[model samples]
Target: MLGLWIAVIALVGPFAAKLADVQHDKVTDYLPASADSTQVAKIEEKLPGGETTEMVLVYHRDGGLSAVDWETAAGQVAEITRQHELIGGAPKGIPSKDGTTLMYPVASNEPGANEEQRDKLVNDVREVAQGEGGLSVDVGGTGALATDSGAVYDSLGGPLLYTTVAVVAVLLILIYRSPVLWLVPLVVAGIADYMSMGVAYGLNQAFGTTVSGQSSGVMTILVFGAGTDYALLLVSRYREELRRIERPYEAMVAALRGCGPAVLASSGTVAAGLLCLLAADLNSSRGMGPLGTIGVLCALIAMLTLLPAILVLVGRRVFWPLVPAFGSTPKQRRSLFSAMGSSAGRRPLTVLASGAVLLGALALGSLNLPGPLKQEDSFVNKPEAVVAMETLAKAYPGRGSQPIDVITPQGRADETLAAVLGTPGVDSAEKGRTGDGWTEISVFAKSAPQSAGETATIKSLRDELKGSYVGGDSAQQIDLEVTNARDTKIVVPLVLVSVMLILIGLLRSLVAPLLLVVAVVAVWGASLGIGGLVFEPLVGLKGTDPGLGLLSFVFLVALGVDYGIFLMHRMREESLAGAEPATAALTALRTTGGVIASAGLVLAATFAVLTNMGLVQLVQLGFVIAVGVLLDTFLVRTYLVTSASVALGRKVWWPGVLSREPGPAEPAGSSGPAEPPRQPESLRAP
Candidate 1:
């Protein structure tokens, strides 16, 4: 099924992209009025003090800033100001202050300009800036960011295909140690990727869903990451089976049957978590939720259907080098899983306490970390914008302002704001336009955005201005940031509650759910603390994109919890066999610990590559998520898995609904107390 699905998808995937590409907006319509908006309207609106509005322009010159270069920079500023379409110019700079090579501000020609116009206008400015010189100049920021981003998105498809093929080839080389062994997983994963792409593209085309550059690359990465993971688990057991059974097909079937359920549940849980992102208010964010869900879902479907069929067809060659051992089943007792389990079980409290303290300390930094979604640093110091900014800043203290436009629909002009121009909090206020008798006033902030201080004040100022001027029939609108953050944080407990409830039903335990989320929460705090540590030293484009921190919190809290589920499920199985609490705890660690660790390592590393992306948001996002996953898998999960088991003891499988029936007596390991019980079908030797 995986192979066939791939075949069908590969045949049609391009057609799907082509159809969806038709909706691509070269020209944007009115302001976005609905959640379903998929065009240039996705471009953020610029308010007087609203978020993501200002552009950072970098200046370049030969051999740094000389007297002549400063003069040239001033000339460049004059050149930019000549374009009268936009209401203003990016202010000039003072290179003497703080090594700010060049800086200033520029905005759209029309206030109501949609995303398409803004993007084209900015790109045109960049082109115009570039045309003036011999210097190598590049323009960035949200305006240029999206334009550059689109090209990057188109490039990902080809690279992703290459990456998928490369990953399979590499995995086969390392694990099988022979090029011949590469063909099986390569073909299987390739098919899965192909099939998954078709579904993703089909959905996008049908729904006008937009897949950005980061998401595009991520889809490929996940397919490779997960496909390789599933293959590894299956192949390890398959090799074990081949040594015991002469019938290769039967051996393969047994391995598949054993690993099948775990794979399904793991994939399902990941997909479910990702789907929750759809609740985000941003269309760009909401659009991604479904793509991630579909990719994981496809991987799950492929593992269940197509992989089995392929294994059946391939026969003995799947384990060609190793001859089949006859008569006896491969040894199963005293496995590596039992070793780790027993060790952790012995020191459960120590391990659990240590992990809790470590994560708690990391959580403290997150509380104080500042900044919101302002893209100042994202501006790639292009020579024209930078020089232009430098000239203005040098000449005027606050000319290059990040303005907040407050529109009041009423009989009065925005004279209240006009009256507050000399007020303390404000650097300056200028009366803007009047539409439908509604007056617009612009407020210029004196301070650079820092954490929530300026953000909160700006919000307050906007509110006061609105209250002072708004009439009975006139309404006030503020466009700062509509984050799902606060609401999401509040509902997180609810989401965890919902997840806990599901676990209770699955594992038939109430206490088990709390332990899992607690372990998950521990990892979440640690991730945030670590993110602050990483950012404390980074003095680049990372600071400009505020969504980076938010993404870290989201990814770490959600995806990092997955291994907990996998670990706990195995623990419950081991405990029901009438093993003592310590014994059962050790058993789960021995088996699930090693595999979960490897999975986490791969997952963390995979996300780490996101840091290499050209985009700042993706880079920050990639690093933080990658670290969180590693911490969860290695630091938190390793300790908590055994600790929770020992702590819960008999109630690990509470309600006794999933209790095991009696089986043949088995001996305990002398190395340590074994979680004594005959193997259940789920973890049994064939």
Candidate 2:
């Protein structure tokens, strides 16, 4: 198995390096294909100019602009025009009413729709449009914003990977308390990540899957986070099995047999939940589904095959100072989980009620979450484009600084321009780039971009334009908000039902699946509630990512159920072995709780790395998932689920064979004596 994996790695390693080359972060790549913004983008690409790159140069001063400042702005604009082949002739400066700011709109067809060309054009323009003294100059517009956002996304590759690996390694060292044991799984996870990348690249080639920076970054996160999780479960079980079995190879087999089903089921749930994203209208969301599945499956394969082969070859010495000698029993001492299970078993109702109420209260914080994030506020740090937009918002109050694109048939171009000019909130309208049976009309709103008034104006245009397509940076944001809402409605229910069905099939019990589903759903709500409380007041974020609700809900519900499966699967195994319901519940918690906690910490820590990312959406996603995983691990799984199981006894598995009383004859497949096995000393409550 090890030899085969090494050969496979050799075959696929080169493709992994090529994955980033195929990734795109264009605005249209993320938009819904059916949206007007998306249609406008596609149609413009077919027009004569082939989708022009647009930018705005802002020159501002706290004091009124002097004659020198005016000449400096004109000279800079002229220099930019001289340096680059702009679509229109030289740009004309539009001075602010306050006489403190001058703005120039620059458009160029040379770059067309090529991102690299556009980035180069924007950078070249920036070099000439430098600010000196009290005069502040910034390059801001859709093209510049895309470039800034793309740079941040591009940087996410190396830093994000290294940080995640470092975080997981530290957590593993702490969990194992061994010098060498942590390295094996981490290396295996890295290998799995490499394999996943190659497969992702292949998927893109074979199916034309849209690979965006956001989706690719998420794929890497899943490869490390979920991959490490499977490794922890397998390693813990192998350590336990080594104490009973004489040989390392046999012990590894025993561990795989014992824990493999639960791992498979958990990973399956996550894959299914992610696959539900395919139903979404947004291109990014749909693309994420397949790439994420590839990550999980690759992780699953490596942990199951390569990890076991390596451990078997290394033998018991791989465990170092804490090696599990043959036929040796671990020291018997009461653990934290034993005490927790005891408390839950003693007062299950009170514990369950308290947890539910706490979750309910936290969920109310979602109501306090800020509105949809604006493009200017999307970055964690203010780039030149965002700064320029901020300056424009202040200096050009009550007028739009960004152009609103309206694509219409050539025959209707005149009528559309007239209607756009007559629109109540349109500050100005002009026809541009007539070709290929389409005419592009640039409309500037009477209000600031992405503001409530501008949003209203966009909706009004869509209503009046009929055959015309209205789109731009602000229009794309509107489309994103609307599409995310639509996806949430469609995808959330699908995830819930899909995950629940998987749980039911795995557990073979209606009640148990329902309980696990409810717990995870509650975790999702509480985590988002926490984000609502912290995002604006603490993080200084102005608004939430529109996709946060849908994405977080899917991740929490899917990944959060993983710990529950570990605990409940053990519980079911114990019950099937003829242990009484209460004993089985407590024993399951006592035996599996520590490993589950360790896995949870590793997963949460890996995702928490995203909180430090530069994008607001990534920060929000990482925070919510990390918090939700921790809650599910420490609170819901440890306290509430265990308490409920103890409270309900056998009925937690209602309608399943285990729910009934064992007959006088020995329980089928019982390895121990007919009577229940004696409780272990380590599991005893102090």
Candidate 3:
């Protein structure tokens, strides 16, 4: 098995290394294909220069701009015009009303659709447009912002991987306490991550799947987080089995057979939830579905196959200091989980009510969440492009800083230009390029980019100009927000229904599935509510990412349910063994509680690493998922779910065989059979 894995890794390693090469962070890549902005972007790429690279140069002084500063700005603009193939003509300076800032709009077609060349153009312009001691000069526009954002995205690969690995390694060490034992799962998870990357890259190539920085980064997180979770569950079960079975190989097989159903069900739920993203209208959301599934499935395969192979090969000694001696029973003591279960059993209603109220309170914070994030505010730290945009916003408060692109058929170009110029909020309109039966018109609004007035203007243009498409950075942002809202309404329900069905199939009980779904949904709401409180006030984030709610819900529900599965599956096993409902509930909690807690810590910690990322969206996402997982682990799964089960007793599995009273033939404390009875068909591992 080891040799087979080694060969597979060698074959896929090159493809994995090349995954970064195909990733794209273009504005259109994230927009829905059916959106007007997306249509405009596609048509523009087929125009004279393929795609125009637009930028704005802002030269400003604290007090006021002098003649020299004006001259310097003009000279730099002239230099830029001479060095590159500009689209319109030499840019004319547009001074601020207060005379504190002078701006020149620059556009070039030389770089076209090549991101590398476009980045070089922006950098070259920045080098030439330097500011002196009293003057501040910055390049701000869609092109420059894309370059800066792409740089951040590109840098995420190595650092994000290293940081995730380091975080998971530390957690594993603490959880295992055995110095060498932690290395086995950690190594296997890393291998799983590499395998996932290869598979993701293949999906991109074979099916032309969209590979964005956000999707790829999320894929890496799932590979490590979900992979480690599977490892923790399997290892914990292996340790328990080792005490009973003599041969190391036989013990490993028994362990797999014992815990395999729960592990498979857990991963299956996550994959199904993620795949629901395919129904979303947004491109980025849709792309994340398959990539995320690839990560989870890869991790599942590695943990089940390669991990067991290695543990068996290394023999029982692999456990080292805390090795479980064959035929020896573990020490008996009152553990923390036992105490927790006892408390819940004593006052089930009180515990359940308190947890519900706490979650409800946390969910109220969602009302405080800020508005949708603007492009300039997406970064955690202010980049050059963001600084320029901020300066422009303050300097030119009466007009938009970004251009609004209007694409129309060449035959109707004159009519469309006239209609755009007559729009209510339009400041100016000019015809630029005409090719491939399409004509491009650049329109500027009287309000700031992504502002309410600008959005209204874009909508008005779309309403009036039936054949023309209005698009640009601001329009794209509008499209993205609308698409995200639409996706949320569609995808959320699909995720809920899909996940609920999976749970029902696994547990074979309607009530059990409903309970798990409700718990996870509560976790999602509370997590987002926490984000609303922290994002604007505590973290100083200006706005929330549009897709934050939907993505976080999917993750928290899918990932959070894993613990519930681990706990409830064990409860079902005990009940099947003829134990009373209450006894089975407490027993399951006692046996699986510690492992679930460890697994939760590892999953939450892996996501928390994203908080250190450069993007505000990533930070918000990381915070919400990490907090949600912790809440699920310590509160919902441990206390509320357990209490509810103890309170409900047999009805928790309503309509199932376990829900009924045991027959007279089956004694209360009698062992049902010498060997455990086979699991029901629905309960068997896939």
Candidate 4:
């Protein structure tokens, strides 16, 4: 399949030029207002303060931009604002608050316009500023900022790119210690990623699916880590076979025969686990199910097909100076692998018990985690929207903040507000009272909605709006700015649950499938709790984009479960070999432990890079997943499984067929002894 893919690409490269336009960007990617965010609809809705397209604000003073200069700047701003027809057209004027700095508001006439609008807007600005005296302007806003974020990869991302690639490559080379063997997986994985992402884009186009910008980073981690993992499984088996088999093609066959089932099973479970992400209600969260699964599947297919074919084609040279360490004669059972098996065959209890307690304890945190799903919550630091919103809040009639639209047919806006203000738990309402004819009263409270007092006030307001006004609270818009955010929380959880059930069926597991879900939830909760504890008192813990919560949980559980499945299945395999359950678990841990650790670290670092990105949601997600992968890979995989295996011992299987009988007959021509080892240290399994 991989060969066919490479061949197809080669064959189609030239023809595609004549076929139809091949886009570098996905159709979904080009959607107006960013289809990836759930907030789009809400943001697009008409509310107070008016929605404005993002515009860059550039002003200089003094020794920079001056007041007289700013007056000219303001004049220039007004002129541009008048001439332009953009969402946030040229600033009406540069307001000089300090008399030294200029404040110009740039508007895009077309808020959701395409590249054409951006180009015209840019050119328009340049024309207007042909030669303004002592006036300097640098465009900066959503359009500019998003461009800058992407450009981060284009510029400083160079070192980051090299670092990521080189780290993975270097690690692979070190582990495999065979340059020729090392390079094979990298190339195949790269090709797989390209095909998968491209196909995913195509699928999204056909289905109207949307993906977050961070999807790219996740894809990168999946391709590198999962790709290398698959390749490691295949090549390691191939090497093991070479020692026993003389012929190159024959060795390849033997390798596949010996290890193919495990690889398939391993990759299958990982893919199945990730497929659970379809349960995510958030577009940003659930979209990864297919995106990541496809890449992993493609890599698996490559490992199965391209790797073997290439090895056969390359003959003996695949190992280079390593030569064929494997020979014609059947080789001795590996002391390490065999010893591991034997020890696991002995005492499995200790191993399983220790590991289980640790993971379960960590899993506790997930239960209390808040379900955050909206795109707006991720803003930790103050942003233009926030600052402007705060400024407006301070300036509005009810302190110039968000207005609650009370739908009561009976009362005036001012009277209703006054009534609500007088109600219990109400700190203060900035509005005087409900005004004549207006049932909805804009009320400003002393506290932010995030504060308990505010929430309590909102509840009181709702009650008043329901009882005090002619209409009920549901029908009327309360001046409360938080209703939609609360509504989002309600919706996102149902989505996550749906996605999880779908995943459970795909993974074919009951005992531990939920563990991944639990793990993800725990990590998410812990991160938020910790983040809140640290940030809440400092600047008031800003809730992250609710999408980040779902996104983190989805990815952590989906990807985190993948690691779990790999270890669990391997532990099961060892147990079946007659090692006591505890020992088998340890054996599984030891063999898979290094790979899990390495994979997690690489992925965690990749995600951490997003924290440096300075986006609220991105940083929140980075923190959550970074904590999650660490906990999952190290604590759960290494610590928990070992303990569970030990504690369960022989009965871990219960009434299962395996527990009822002696282990199956050792395969013919096998070197494992009929007798199990007494000591636990000797047991190990992958």
**Model 1 lDDT at residue 526:** 71
Error of 4 at 613 (Å): 4.2
lDDT tens digits, residue span 1-686, model 3: 99999998999999999998999988777998799999999998889867888999999998999999988888989988888887777988999989999998998877355688889999999989999979999998988998999999998888899999999999988888888989999899899989988999999999998999989899989989999999988888788778878998988888898889989999999999999999988888999999999999999999999999999999888888889998897788888888999998889999999999999999999999999998988999889999999999999986888999999999999999999999899999999889999999999999998899999999999999998898999899899888898999999999999888888888878888899999999999899899999999998999999989999999999999999998899888888876778887888888888888888898999999899999999999999999999999989988999999999998999877777777666632234634444432111110
In terms of lDDT, model 4 sits at 0.51
Off by over 4 Å in 4: 1-3, 11-70, 86-112, 119-163, 273-281, 315-317, 320-324, 327-543, 594-616, 661-686
**TM-score, model 4 to reference:** 0.66
Candidate 2 or 4, higher TM-score? Answer: 2
- For model 4, state the Cα shift of residue 92 in Å: 5.8
Please give, for residues 308-359, the per-residue lDDT of candidate 4 as tens digits: 8877778777777666565544333454433543444354455445544554
Q: Which stretches of candidate 2 lie over 4 Å from their true place?
A: 111-113, 664-686
Report the lDDT of model 2 for residue 652. Answer: 91
What is the model-wide C-alpha lDDT for candidate 3?
0.89
Give the deviation of candidate 2 from the true structure as CA RMSD.
2.4
Per-residue lDDT tens digits of candidate 2, residues 369-448? 99899998899999999999999999999889999999999999999999999887999988888888999999999999
TM, every model: 0.75, 0.97, 0.97, 0.66
Sorting all predicted structures by lDDT, with the top scorer first, yields 2, 3, 1, 4
Q: What are the Cα lDDT values of the candidates?
A: 0.55, 0.90, 0.89, 0.51
